[model samples]
Target: MSNVVNFLTAGVFGGTTLLALKSGVGCGLSGLRRRETLFLAFVYALTALIIGAIAGSIPVNATEQVVGLGVVMHLIIGLALVYFGIRTKKAWLSDRKDISRRTFLLMSLPCPACLAATFLSCLVFTSTTGVSGVAAGGVIGGVFFAGIAGGGAATSWITRKAGMDNPSTLGNVMLFLGLFYLLCLLLVPAYLQAQDAPAFGIATDPSGMLLALVLMTALIVFGALADRIRHTAERGGR
Candidate 1:
């Protein structure tokens, strides 16, 4: 029962609500079977959880190293994901042959935000159950697979019913959610670190502050310019 409780609380519910919404929109956007795509994602996520849990058991501060790596790459990954959203809305189908794959990757692959949640879940489960990392990982990862996949399926169904199963809608959600993630990646990590809080393993220093300020400025400029360009193009014929 403790394992079950840990699975539900730690693994199933560990991910952010925003991430759940992102997964739903991504599933809709992929035009693939949500279960199948998310299954693949679950496989990837489970593998990572197992490996991460085992690594965490080592005497060294593996959490710091692992989460540090994630923090380092999140900005780049966030930018790329936002681009994916934009391109899907504007680009031809030929350019999006791998939308399903990308969606699955978003759901599972090296996502910094999700990675943070995952390791935490693993730690909680293992600690509570006094089980080996491998045992805890399997329990947590299995429940995560079921919960996320189930939620994604339901969300896709709802969106379909609402007539939102289109690239434009998917792209819009992706764009907004991706940007939100960027903001979190940019600011939340350092703030959490400074407070000695959980969530991220980012360094709390002036460099992080400088990076955030610079990148935020760049994002604002690019967003304004792109919005202007898009609006102008829409008004091109008028």
Candidate 2:
């Protein structure tokens, strides 16, 4: 059912982000290459399916339950990345002179914003009345975060490999882009619901999805730009 779809979407987005971050992808607008992008997307979607199913089966209500759970999941993942990045800073320092303790705080900034938005949406919605509602909400929330995580990972991987002093900036910025999309989800639905809306109408709203797409496109573009910048800097140094 819809729950199944939501689960799948969540798994894809979340899984892809983690995988890409762990393994450096590539940079350049052309770097993702059509083949690599498709492959990574497929991998993310499949992983999302497995994880989403397991996460969905925890005897939770569709309302505040799923939303709350999703927030916790996102927060945990975001924090973990910050931690890993912090731990790796020293190791990367010899290569990146500008890497500093403050970078840790910068990396951690997106979590709270995302966490708050997720929690607020659940509370504001205040109703998980049926399977349909649950599925709809889940997809919106799941895809939004997945986009954040996945996109962040993709951008980060590209930047890091491009040898930018602050390659993670790409990922971190993309993560915030995801967070903003989440905020849109929170506010848009509430606005519609308050105005006495139909579930179907809200379901079709493209803002969240569109935002994600735009972000993904931008990340690719920026990745390409970052590569050029790195190349130029290296030449200038010589």
Query: lDDT values of the candidates?
Result: 0.61, 0.45
- Give per-residue CA lDDT, model 2, range 137-227, as digits (tens): 3543454444534554565565658775353443444345345444545566657766887742554446865776588568647855776
What would the TM-scores of all predictions be? 0.68, 0.30
- Once fitted onto the true fold, the runs of candidate 2 whose alpha carbons sit more than 4 angstroms away are 1-38, 47-60, 94-238
- TM-score of model 1 (CA atoms): 0.68
Q: List the residue pairs that clash in candidate 2.
A: 11-48, 12-44, 12-48, 26-158, 28-224, 29-224
Writing each residue's lDDT as its tens digit, candidate 1 over 1-238 gives: 8667666654434553334445544664556685565865576456646754674556546666766766666666677667877666654332433344454455444466566656766665555666677765676566555555666676678778998666655566666666776777657766777788765555667787688768867986887688778778878967
* Model 2 alpha-carbon miss at residue 192, Å: 15
lDDT, residue 72, model 1? 64
